[model samples]
Target: MKLQKAPQAAPELVHLEALLGKASVTPLDAGCQPYLAERLEELGFIVERLPCQGVDNLIARRPGVPSLAFAGHTDVVPAGQHWQVPPFQLSELGGYLYGRGIADMKGGIAAFLVAVERALATGHELPGLMLLLTSDEEGEAEFGSRVMAQHLKTQGLLPPWVLVGEPTARSHSGDTLRVGRRGAVSGTLRLSGRAGHVAYLPPTANLLHRALALGQQLAALEWDSGAPDFPGTVLHVTGLEHGDWLDNVTPSSATLRFNLRYSHKTSKDAIDQRIRALVPGDLDFQLDWDRPCEPYFSLFGEAQPNFLTRVERAVFKGLGQFPVLSTAGGASDGRFFSALGCEVIELGLPNASIHQANERVEKGEYLRLIDIYQALLESL
Candidate 1:
């Protein structure tokens, strides 16, 4: 048999390979931002490193008006063992690029970088462009985008438009763009009762029983019919616990953990009040809520009101079809910038394998992402 040479990787793959090879997990940058800053600096951007609460953030901006911020994260979720290929090494197999954060975001970041390189090479005068890189998106997100956003707001340096490179596509790379996301609230619910023997249960009403009824009520109630731009509110019981297993004794207290992904039509206080009403008047119970990301929506029509029309047309020019404007996913860092009056939109590769073993992104889709981002830049 004749010997054959193996094909070389694409240039875009080369850039992504270097990024994936870095050991950045959760809140750790693992030196990825320095590498990106070098590239941005070469493009006439002034790079600034902002470290907050042990998390690394980079802001690269070119001097000009009408700034557009391109936001992304360098941090990735932990890559657990048991994968067909090394999770941290960029692997090309059957026309797909596999890595830890390829589908979720690193690939999106790489695409934007490639797009900027191409645009700058062509001598296209881009309006004020800012790259907001953070290392805290996959973690608590406390010292990440929010930190930069607040700092920029205080200095009156907040951009008028922001593009978050979060993986939002469902089936195709440009098939869907997230206009907004529902708000999330999570915490524990506690109920108290007296302890007693199972056989003699007069004074001890079972906290578990009352909690079960409350859980059922919350799950069954229909909060809203969902707005045209948002989804209906829903509550989920994540965990339930009581005293240790004792066949002869009744537990004194019970705790139930829950999360609610509510729409813009619903408020946290409203949901809290509604939950309060479900608990029995005689039961001694308390429900604590943790509000993380609030619900937000961007108006989309022709072009003037929101930037959705221009982005949609750009996506069509790149992918040969318009994308659906949706708000059906979990919250993202985009919400932080949106609160500052920036028109924010999320666009990236399909999210089929994010946060899973052997997370992969299609090679064709990866290339298309670059095209979509470049076209968006030109339009802006």
Candidate 2:
């Protein structure tokens, strides 16, 4: 790829470059949120800093009806060893901006801000508009968008629609738009048995042997045939643990940790019941469940045609491209809004370099995203 200097530094890149200079790796704001808050305040937004635990969140709102919220995270994953350019320093290489979070997020945030800036400058009337930013999205995420969502709900300020800049596009900036996400549920299975020497005959116990059989049963059990809008509910045994290995002794207990990414067709209780049924009657066991995100689709079944139609039109007008509406991806903050009865969609730069070494996004795509966001904001 031949590198070319961009015509000039676009306003959005100026902001992104400033953000990329900050060392705000996951769970740390690195003063990025405060910097953004100041800029938003200057744009006539009511900015509020909401800090939960060590994670910083910022909510900036403008008065109007029919609310539209733009959500993004300022955090970037830790940069691994290989990088032609410093991960924290924004550099243009091969007409692409190289930096962590540029593709995964910060670029999206910068674009949205620029969109708002241009819209206001053009004297365009915007409906209730807001930005929800968190530093916890790339980390444990318990205190980030999750906390902000709860707070918004309490204040009766939850937006009717939300746009999350989560790098959903594949081949091009507007090629893919994530309209839904799968839910993730995890469980730990503890199987117990009497401990005894393997060589001794009196009272021998083999928890590993029993566990293997139970695991096979669970693995073979059919969860669900994927629905049209979502993939099948699948489960995988992520880890297996047992006591120290000994030539002549059998471990007394075994533990298996399994996780499942499921759709709305299944429930935690239903999955729990299936596991209980698969357990052998003679074995003593316990199953514990933890659910992080719930499945949601904004344009599935008898869903909102008007809202999605507007979004489609905006994409066409902004990028001269028709985006593919999809639900294929891991969990994101979009789920929180979906749970709050708000329509959520994710759109951003191509994700080929997201979370990878020398992560970068096309400078052209970054500019196009700002235009897309601006058009989407106008349509809303």
Candidate 3:
């Protein structure tokens, strides 16, 4: 594919182009972390590499009393079909930079790095600044920031303030900031019933019918009206399956999978109990649950007043617009840090095309994001 070069791009855009050039798909760093580690080391950060079960994690810290931390992922979802340019290569068209991870992340990562570099060049005192990057965040997250957070907790290195570089902006680069995220709980349900000929099996004994009915009941459930910072709890039946392929035979078993994105107004325990209660008494069934994250609000305890104000002020200064505090998104690595008592906020480029074909972000937005991040660091 012929790529159109970015005309006189800034250092951050150049860096982001380099990052997008590497194909670090989910669960694979593809040298992205190593490259970042080298750059960070040159900037006087004490870089630590923590590799867990094939996933790469990096913690780069500047020696000082820790005040702020930046968190992000190096991994991106697979570049699926349909692209005007190579998915792994950075392409410029119509004043936009196209790549797989540019908007979803890598763009944010590059912006932060350049922001740090520029801030340090100006002799800015960013005492106790840290950057946390992981390769497993786009995957199962079994061995990424979750492990890093645990390690930081043990070493008493967890920062009080965390800024996650997730693509949170709705309209422009700094229009919205994610003050919190909704929690997710996913479940796989298996129902067992006696297999029989279609003519002999009654409606009560049909596993498929039972599965569909249960799915409807679960979907129709209304959990809550939600709080001011979050939306209402919603459930989605992701998958349903049965073993039998023959049309005339009733399947002996059926399986249903579902997920719930709930707000802070509800607890995981409450969702779990409510789901269990919905199961019929006579059905032979089993339910397995996976709680990936819990909802968190941006409350800094005793530090709330100064820390949040600084962030908001920096954003406004950089973008010429005050950002709206939002809590409307799926779970992210920020949830882990928030759970560990850090006041977490997510800020980055616009997210309109993330995880979609031909993903791209405006070059201007990318450049401005660097200023916003730099301003944030300087404010600290």
Separate clash counts for every candidate: 0, 0, 0
Task: Write candidate 2's Cα lDDT for 1-380 as tens digits.
Answer: 44443334666777888788898998998989999999998988889999999999999999876478999999999998888777887888877888888988998998889999988888876757999999999888889988998999999999888889999988777788888878888989999877777667353247887777777777777877666766888989888898788877778899988899888778778888988888878889988987567788785325544666767777888778798988898889888888888888898989999999989998888888888888877766
lDDT of 1 by residue, 164-216 (tens): 99999987788898888888999688999787787777533766777787778
lDDT of 2 at 205: 47
Per-residue lDDT for 1-380 in model 3, tens only?
56787654655666787788899999999999889999989989999999999999999999987778999999999999998888997889988899999998999999999999999999996788999999998889889998999999998999988999999998788889898888888899999978888988888778888899999998899988777877878899999999848989888899999998887789888987888899899999898988657888777566545677777887888889899988887778888888889889899999999999999999889888999989888877
TM-scores, all models, native as reference? 0.89, 0.92, 0.88
Colliding pairs, model 3: none
lDDT of each: 0.84, 0.84, 0.88
> Which portions of model 3 miss their true places by more than 4 Å?
1-3, 7-10, 193-217, 237-256, 280-282, 302-305
Rank order by lDDT, top first? Answer: 3, 1, 2
Tell me which of candidates 1 and 2 scores higher on TM-score: 2
Kindly give the stretch of ten consecutive residues in candidate 1 with the minimal lDDT sum: 1-10
Highest TM-score: give the candidate number: 2
User: How far in Å is the alpha carbon of 3 misplaced in model 1?
Assistant: 16
2 or 3: which has the higher lDDT? 3
RMSD list, candidates in order: 3.1, 2.6, 3.0
Q: Give the TM-score of candidate 1.
A: 0.89
